[model samples]
Target: MATTINEIIRDSLELIKAEHLNLTPDNYAKVFCKVAKQKGVIVEDCQKVDKYTKKLDPNIVTDMKRFNIGNIDELLAFLVAKLNRANEGDALKMVNTLATLTKRVLQAITLLHDTKATSLANASLERLDFHQNLQSIDLVKEKWFDFISNYDDSYLKKLDAFGHVTKDDLEVMVRDLIKILSKDDSTELYKTLVPLIIASLSPSIASGMNDELASISNELRNSPDALGTPALQQEIKHLISKRIDLDKAEVQKKVAALDKILDEINKKILELIQSSNFSHEQVKVIKKDLQSINFQQDSFETVQVKLLNIASSLESETRSLSEKMISNQETITKLQNRISKLESALLVAKQEVKEDYLTHVATKRALANEMNRVEDAFMRYKIDYTLCFIDIDHFKMVNDTYGHEAGDVILSTVGKILRKYIRQVDFVGRYGGEEFLVILPSTELAQAIHFADKIRAIVEQFKFLYKNERINVTVSCGVSQRSQQKSKDETLSAADGFLYKAKEAGRNQVMPVL
Candidate 1:
């Protein structure tokens, strides 16, 4: 009996899912290439597809009989038919054909979500590298360790809650961008393992026990009730214990290396905390803030969300409390005014009872309580905002032509422009060189896109000066909005994919995904 097409697609998808591949365009090509080799489907021809597909050009399969690269609708229909016919013996042959078809469709969709994941990884790393205050044992061992450990999909999920990215979004996103300085090709293991490690750090993007994982877990289960629980529930704990048993020597070696780093950071923190020249009150406040900024998780996304939320809440609460205190302080002004009036009305009215300036200081304690409330609220709502990633068009050319100094000026100038256009409450940060990330609290994608367009327009019209030369700049933007229960990394990636299209379609445009 001949195998059906849908079955082939299903099996292929399962294979990808089993391997935790994100169905990226590049990975999709790889999957097809693997399938073709296994089924002996003109491996050389498949290699041609891989070569052309990697370039992301559309002419790769112009002559392939099974593929209709021009009509996505027709191609998808045929691919679906092939998927319905999947079987173990002939599955690879059909999947290879479907892969060529899907690759075209995906290229149109773009899969920059992997890129976004990469971005988040870099952002989280920046947070770790620049934090500068890791002085206590708790901060060093607990906070930093936890931040590094949990830097996977969960971070993206939290960002999604903030309305930045979504899950399984059919768009190209740039995720997990690790900077590779070393040229040794022997680093394939390092390259592959690094992204996986970074992805794992973000619990949001990390694949949980899917059907394939479930099968593996079932084989390892010791109890009849194992079916009820996911293997990931005990994944970390189990891995730790298993490593202790199977690779005790390796664990000890890493422990010795890690201990040296921890001691150095702790010593630095202690020195700052114990300085005799600093005021006792200042030390107390520093300690208090340090205690509040707890880093219990190993994921950078987790740490960033927690720390930023806490800091923002603390600042907001301080502002609110200060406002109220100012209002109360107005009463003192009124009383002082009244006392002046009495002195003017009566000759030598005994220098009106001396005002006690210290009385107002009591408000600080009350303000602390209000700050706690604000911090708690912030923690709840940090993930409830929307975020957009914006990339500047031909920014490198600007840098290369104008030099890094001029590039810095351009970046600073752009930052000011974005700040001016965006709402003061919206969070805008330099996502790195030539890229900016914006977080909109309580705003959806449609509203965000409108804002993005405004930024694009303002940027296009703006001119920068390097010495006497006038430089005009424009930007290409991709806008992605997060769905209610999706991963932020994927959503950001989708927006990034749109941005890529914006560039491809021509620079200086806003391409927002619906």
Candidate 2:
């Protein structure tokens, strides 16, 4: 039987699920663009687009459009083909627009399925009027299902050919969805389907199926049956017959590397021993150096035992490290939840407590402590992502015109929203009056800037209703990811400069210098 479109989509989804990696929107966008182009829907060829453009998935129309995914697919393919054909520097410029589209699509997709409305989701739906007549689109839903069932097997094969799906890969897939959905932002189809694609990549998102292939190495090493009596073992000939080829290429490479290291160490030792200043003191230093080398040799020898002792050590190390990373991730998550709760509590307390100087100082102290806790957590990861500071554009006017109470409300509202929008790994603090700082762990400047834009939009659109008068607010933001060490003053000064620039250019924008 020829596969229906729904079956094709379903099988493709299954193939995606079979992999042990997270399927990000970027991956789907790339694959979708490839498939759409192959089907002659997209104008450009997949080979021509840059990785980010491919992730964007520009302009492909489908019989069943979901979240302009088809449009994104077509556009990305066209851009990719165009870029490759032209081989121009403009490819870099394409990234900003692609990234913006990606954010819009992702935010939109998240909202369509969300029963509970989040600010991002609400904004997406609002932009497209996605919620209006949303519950009454049965034909659209049916067509989408049919499209998935009859999706081509060749497309799945193409996806497999793309090979390993990394975080970057996943982003491409999402961008593709965005492109398709962008065509008819009025439709909520892409918004519905994008999440479903993400769902398929769940296994990869979980414990990682990549580890499964090597897990047998550990089981064989630990199995008592492998070491049982010969007579008993003789009954199961297959036990000894099984000679699973474990990839020793990496081990061999390591061995070669170690040998080179040893050679260098030996040369150094010989030089010390033959030194003109050779004496009891020199001899002692040589012995210490030799002991250090021996200690390393001992460690390597211990590791080599498994490789040489009919049991590979790869399993033990991979499992151990994976577990540690997972635990650390969980710890970060818990800490984030705790911090969010604390922020909410503090905000509530601000409303309840008297706005006296002593109270304000005490509250500020508490907020600072929370920020410190977030910094400590980042320290444990030994990552450079926690670098952050805040700038509130010339806010003396708010204090002067709006009265201190209104200024307080504005500050509090901004602080609350910042805390809410940021992920668990991110931190926000009241650095000083009309100034707040936010630290983002594991984020690059580009990512931080994108997030800042999203938050800025939220603040701009927020309805500040106080005593029946409507209040509108705007902010200038400067975001950067710290990759090198600089004095605190210097770093803050640079960020402040960016904020000033943004204000100069026009407030309500995020400027990031990489």
Candidate 3:
């Protein structure tokens, strides 16, 4: 007698347990089929599926194998998806063909030079533009067919008035006429506008941009036609942006210097007030008024005006003390000399704040400021950026074997290398000892990685000479994109993480393995 279904299931479970296999459905099914076959009972379902699969198209069979479709349900879903995708491809092709047809028809219609023909062409072009996708292709086709059916040939008669003029000749004549009109309009407009623009720029700001402005002015006057090209327009825009950034940087430097000067002057006044024995009530009142000025809360102009008034009062009061304080004349002269020296020192301090003393590149503080600025641009304008975190390999060993002086040389050389390779807009800074951060504005991850690798290769090939001893050096770099991270800090962390990974995977390489 044939094995009963209950007996087959019982034996399948026993076999699974005996073999120490997991009691999964697939395992149970295989065991059950094996036991049934031993008892002379054929499982017809497996046979049916195999037979059906053999009848499918070879390409479909290959696709099933490629996708690992093991059962009928999955196979059916895959086939349905494949069919849907094919239908979409066909629909896209049809839409593209329709668009091309409509564009060609419009081009042919525009050559007739009739007002009605031009209007019809423009309307059809607008409709085609509106229906740019497969979903609206049917409506576009209907409108295009209607336009083609109603198109009149009477417009061609106007062309016959120009005796023996071929269609090609008419086309050339129309194109030449349009070109002349466009050139004259653009040239006259530029001529009238360029002088006014140049005149409006402040002499102080425009002094540095004289060459750029002159180049542009000459272009407008001599080669106005070239300005119509996209390349020339982009060059002009770049020059404008460069000039704006330069002016902004100069203004910021001046403001920072002024701020430092004001602070120093306030400190000197306070010191003089504390040390002075003011016998006059007016001198005491002037000191009290000077102390009342709020540097932090008040605007720069307001602070300047108040300080000026206080200085005038102090000047008048001090005149009376000149005879009484004659013995302190040397001290006063020394203080004046000290103030001058302090001014110079303050300027140097400001420079040091932005520049690293050892590396001569930007300092970490400056890098942070740049990162914040770049982050603002990213957040506000959707402009993307990338960071490269670089660490010199075996730097500690270099310092140990050589000396701290040699290490400094290495750091300085690396900084110079980084600065040399980067663009004007890109920033490279000494993040800390033996490490650097490069901020690449408007850069992509892949491009940044490539850049980092190039830097790595350059450093590896460079020779470090200290005390006439050659030292071999290499660097590991990590790169990350701002767009890939949720925050600027995260982006920096990611770059650092990649840098660590690069160091771990045998230094002197760029991270993310690519």
TM-score of each: 0.29, 0.31, 0.45
Q: Which TM-score value belongs to model 2?
A: 0.31
Please, what are the lDDT tens digits per residue for candidate 2 over residues 397-511? Answer: 7668678887777787777787678786465666667766676755667777777778878888998766677777777787655554353345456666777788788777777
TM-score of 3: 0.45
Candidate 1 or 3, higher TM-score?
3
- Which residue pairs in model 3 clash with each other? none
Lowest lDDT sum, 10 consecutive residues, model 1, at 353-362
lDDT of each: 0.51, 0.50, 0.73
Find the number of clashing residue pairs for candidate 3. 0
Error of 1 at 429 (Å): 0.9
> Global lDDT for candidate 3?
0.73
Who wins the TM-score comparison?
3
